[model samples]
Target chain A: MKKPIRLINLGKTESWKTQAVYHALAEEMTDESPDTIIICQPDSPYLCLGYFQPFDSIFDRKNVELLNLPVYRRRIGGGATYLDENQLFYQFIFHHSRVPVALEKAYKTMLAAPVETLKSCGLDCNLRAVNEIEVNGKRVAGIGGGRINDAAVVVGNFLFDFDFEAMSTVWKAPWPGFRELAKDAVKERVYTLKQCAPNLRMRAVSDKLIELFPKYFNRPIVSGSLSQKEIMASQKTAQVLTDKIFLNDGNTDIPVQPRPLKISADVFIHNKKMFFKNKKINVSFRTDNDVITRVKVEGAVEIEKTIIGITIEEIEHILNSGSSTVLKDN
Target chain B: MSKKDYNFPADLHYDGKNHMWVKKENDNIVLVGIDAIGLDTLGDLAYITLKPEGTIVKKGEPIGTLEAAKMTGDIFAPVSGKISAVNAACVENPGIVNDDHYGKGWMVAIDASDWSTESTALISGEKLQPWIEAETHRMETQGFDA
Candidate 1:
C-alpha cells in the first residue's frame, strides 16, 4: 500500500510562517513521523525571488510599494513569484533515500502531480528544466527545496487565486524597460488558474486538491495541524527573521561581474550603482540588495555603457522628485 | 508533528552546539552549513555574517549569524578551537548554505585540540533523530504547525 500524504493550508498567514511549518515538518519527518508528506499555504502579497537572484532585481520597487507589500526573499532558489490569495502553496516532505538521487530529475518528478492538477484547471501549464510551471511561457508556479536525513523536501506555489496587477507590479527585471517588455513578453505566455478554471474559487480549488492528491499517490490524505514542537520552532525562526543585521547583510568584496551593457546592482551599500562609466563609485552593497552601495563618481563619469545613460536620466528625476530612496542624496 | 531525524552524516566531524558536522577541506572547512530543519523552519537567509578569519572563538560560542529575510539566526561554532579558515563563498552566496549546506556550504574551520569539550554537543548519522525531534517540537509549538 502507498503512504498517505498530508495536506495543509496555512490559509492567509505571513509567508514566513509557511516556511516555519516547512522546517518544522522536515524536523518531524526525520525523528517523530517519517511517514507523511505535507503541503502548506502562505500569507501576504510579495515578490519571492530565487536564492541565486539579487532581490532588488526580483522585486519591482514602484509596483511593490504601491501594493504596500513587505518585499522579502526566500531560502530556496528559483524565479521570483508574486504570492497572494491568488496562490496556494503545496509542499512535499520526503526522505532522499526514498527519492531518486538525481536532484534535477527528482524535482521534476515530484512536481509532475501538481503540473497535472494545474493542467486540469485548463491552463497550458508546463514544467520546465529548472522546476517552474509556466503557462504559455511565463511562470505560474516557482519551485525549490532542501534535504533532511536522506530526505528532500520540495515546495512550490500555484496561482489558484492571485492579483495579476499586484503581481505585475511586484516582480520586474533589473532592466527598467525589460519589465515593460517582459510584461508584454509574458502577456501571451501566462494565465492564472482563475483564467483557466474561471469557475474555480479558492474553496473549489482546494477541494480539488483534497480529492486529487490521494489518487495521485494512491494513498489516503490526512488533514493535520502544527504540533506543539513546530510552533515553537517557527516562533524561534520568526524572531531570527526579524533581526536587521541578520535580514539585511552584505559582503561586497566578492567580485560581481555583470554582463556587458547590463547594469547590475550589488546591494552592499545604500547608494544604487549603475555601471555608467570607467570610474567605479565607492558604493557599499547591502546584503539584501534592497539598499545600494555608495556611487563611484569617476573622472567625468564617462559612459562605458550606452543604455544606462538613458535610464539614469529617468532615475535622476525619480530621485530628485518625491519617492523611495534612490542613491540617497549623495 | 515536527519530525526530527538526526540524519547526521557518518563522515563529518563536529563542533559543540546543537549544530551538526562537516568535513575539513584543503584550506577551507566545508560544513553542512545549517541542518535542514534548522534554516528552513527559520525562514529566509535575510543576512548572514560569519566571524572573519583568525577570530578566536571557543567551541559553541557565537561565531556568526544566519538571518532569514524575516528572521535572525546565530551561526554557532561547529567545533571548539581557533578559527583557521572560513568559506568566503558563503559570505558572497549564502544560499550555498542551502544548496550545499553540509558540503561546499560548510561555514568555518577550527583547529581543535580538545575534542571532548568542543565536540561533545555534536551528533552524526543515526544519532541525530532525538535532537531533530526536539527542535521540531519546539517549532511545532511556535505556530509552525500547518
Candidate 2:
C-alpha cells in the first residue's frame, strides 16, 4: 500500500511565507514524515534567486531597490525569476526514498499533476524535455527542484499571468539594448494561463491539482495545516531566506562570459561583447533548441544573416578561425 | 559486472549510497568526485559550488552542491575530513564535470581525519562490480537508461 500524503492549501500568503513554508517543511522532514504538498500564492511581488546564482551577476541591484522587491534565495536550483500573486505555486516535499532516485524521473512524476491540471483546464500542455510544461512550444509553467536535507523538493508555478516588464527591468543586462532583447525573447517564449484560457481561475487550477496529485502518486490525501514544529521551523527559515549574506553567496567570482539567460529548456538569450580585429563588437542572439533563431550584431549586419540558422559551435568556429575577414564578405 | 553504458573504474573507492568516489592521493589526503552513473543521471550540469578550503566536514555530510538545468543536489563527503582544496575549474565551467569527471573534474580534496577506519566503508576492488550492478538496476527502475 502507498503511504498517505498531506495537502495544505494556503490560498494566499505573504511573499516570503510562500517560499519559507516549503523550505521549513523540507528542513524539518524525517523518514517518518508524510510526503506533503503545499499550494499557495504570494500576496505581493518578490525576486527569487536560484541556489547557485550570484545576485550581482543576474540582477540589476538598482532596479531591484527601486522597485523595492524583497529578494529571496531558494535552495532549489534554477535561474532567478520574478514571482507574484499571479503565479500559483505548488511545492512538493517528499522524503528522498519516496521520490524516484533519478532526477529526470522525479521531475516527470511530480510534474504529472500540473500537466494534467492544465490539460483539464482545456489547454494543451505537456512536460517537454525534463521539467518544463509547454503549450505549443511556448513554456506555460516554471518548474525547479532539488534535494534539501532528507527531502526532495519540487516547486513549480501555474502562471495565471506574468509581469514581463518587471522581469525585463530586474535582470542585469550587459548593454542597454540587451534588456529589450531579453524582454522580447521571454514574451515570445513564455505563455500565461490567462493568455491561453480566458475563463480559468487560480482557484480552479489549485483545486484540479489537489484532485490529481493523489491519483498520480497512488496515495490518499489528507487535508492538513502546518504542524507546530513546521511553523517554528518556517519562522527561522524565513530569517535565513531574507539575509543579504545568503543572497550574495553565489557572487564569489565575476563570471568570464555573461551567462546566457535560459527562458526555458529550449530557449536562451546570449549577450556577449567580443573584439574583432581590435574593434569591439556587441553580439546578442537567441537560440531555440540549440539553433540560432534570432541575431543582432552591432558591428556587422552581414554576419548576422549568415549565422542565423547555425548553432553556437559553428558560430564560434567562424569567429575563432584566425580569419579576420570572415565577416567582411558576408 | 560493469555495464556497457557506465564506467566504474577499479582504482577509485565509492560511496554507493551518496554516488561519490574517492581516490587516495596520500595516506590521508584524497580527491573526490561524482561517479559516472551519478553524472549521467544528472544530465547536463549548469553550476556547482563547493565548500571553501579548510571547512571541516563529517562523513556523509555535504561538501557542496551540483546544479543541472532542472535539478540540484548536495555532493556528500565519502569520509570525514577537512576540505583541503576545491576544484576551481569545475566550479567555473560546470560542463567540465560532464566532460572529465574522473580527472580534471574532481570536486574537492579532503585531508581525511580517519581514513584507516572510514576507508573500509567505501567499496573497491572485488566489491566494486556488484555495487555498480546493484546501483544500475536501482536507477534503471527510476527511468535511467542504464
Candidate 3:
C-alpha cells in the first residue's frame, strides 16, 4: 500500500528554517517512512552558511545579534542564505533511496524535480552545472544537498520577498582590497524566486512542490512529525553547532611561533597568513607551492588523528570531487 | 598540447582510503600528483605545505595538506620514500588545483625505491574511473562531498 504523504505546514517561524527542517527529518528517523515534507519559515532574516564554510566568512556576530536573528551553519555544501518571513521555506525529507548517491549527480538529480515544477509555472528556469538555477542569466534558486545515513533532505526557500541591499552588504570584514567583488559575487550568485519570477505566489510555488514530487517519485509519501527522540537529538546537535568557538574567527591563522620553530624562508608569495605570529604554532598550514605536500600545525602538542599516511592521490580525489552531508535513516 | 592521457600512474596509486597517487620515473625516480577527480572538488585551494626533499620518510608519512575555505583535508603519500621535490608554484597561487590539476597541480615527488608494496594499493586509471563514478554516486546519498 502507498503510504500517505507526510504534509506539514510551518506558516512562519523565527528560528533557522534549515535547522527546523533538519530537526523534523531527524525526528522521523524512528521509522522508515516513504516521505515527509515540512513547510516552514524563519522568524527573522539571518545568514545561513554552508556546512563546510567557516561561520566568520558569512556573518558578523555583533550585527546579527543586534538584529535579533540567529545564524545557522548547515551540513549541506553551497553558499549561505539570508532567510526571513517574506520567504517561505520547504524541506522534503526523502530516503537516500530517493536517488543514487553521487555528490555531483545527486545535486543534479534533486534539482530536476524542482526545475520541472518551476517550468510548469511558465518560468523558463534551468539548472546550471555550477549548482544554481536561473532565468535569463539571473539565478532564481540556489540548491545544495547531502546524505547522512539513509535519508536525504534538500531544503530551500521560495522567496516571497527579500532585502537585496541587506544581503549584498553586511558583516563584511575590513579587508585591504577585493571588497567590491566579494559583495557583487554575493548579489550575482544569489536570488529569490519571487524576485526572479516576480509573478508566482508563495502558495502556488509550495503547491507545485507537492504536486510535481508525486509524479516522479517511486515510493510512498507519508505525513509525519518530529518525534520526541529526534527533537532531543536536534537540540543537542544545535547546541554544539551554536557553540561560541565555531562562531569566532575561523582560527585558521598560524601565528609566528617559537614552539614549532619558525623556519623562515625568503620565498615570497603567501602573504595573507604568517607562521608563528608570536612564536606559537597557530592553526594554519604553510604552503610555498600551489599544492600542499606537507603540513605544519602549531598549538597542537600532539596530532590527535593527523592525516599523515594517506597519499595525495588518495585524498586529492576525496577532497576535491567527493562531498558529504548529514541525513539519518528514518 | 594534446593533454597527457591522464591515467592512474602505476607506482603512485591509492589504497582507496583517502590519500594521493605517485609514480616512479626511474628506479628511484618519482612524480607526485593528485588523482584527476580530487582536483575537481577542492575548489580554489588556499594553502599547502610539503616536507623538504632528502627527508627519510616512512611508508605512511605526512607529505602535506591542502586547505579550502575553513575546512582542511590531509594529503598522504602513495608510497614512503625520501622527499625529492615539492611544487613551489602552489605557494602563491593555489588555484592551480582547480585550474590545471594534472600538470601544474603536481604536489611533490619522492625518490622511493620501496613503493612496490604500496603500489599495490593504488587504483589503476582503467579501474579507477568506474570505481570513482560509483563512489561519486555513493557520496551523494551517504552525505560525502564530491
Top lDDT model: 2
User: What is the clash count for each candidate, in the order shown?
Assistant: 81, 0, 78
The regions of model 2 sitting more than 4 angstroms off are A253-257, A276-281, A299-303, A318-330, B1-5, B142-146
Give the clashing pairs for model 2. Answer: none
> Per-residue lDDT for A41-68 in model 1, tens only?
5556655544334544345567667777
State the lDDT at A58 in candidate 1: 46
| Candidate 1 DockQ, CA atoms | 0.07
Give per-residue lDDT, candidate 2, residue B2.
40
Q: List TM-scores for all candidates, in order.
A: 0.56, 0.92, 0.56
TM-score leaderboard ranking: 2, 3, 1
Ranking by lDDT: 2, 3, 1
lDDT of 3 by residue, A9-101 (tens): 666664743474574464354336545667776776767765544555545556666666666766554555566777666665666544443
Model 1 agreement with the true structure over B28-121: per-residue lDDT tens digits: 4333367665655444454456787778776556677554442233566666567777888877777777776777777777665465554445
In terms of TM-score, the best-performing candidate is 2
lDDT, model 1, position B96: 75
Candidate 2 residue B111 C-alpha distance from true site, Å: 1.7
Question: Residue A219 error for model 1, in Å?
Answer: 4.6
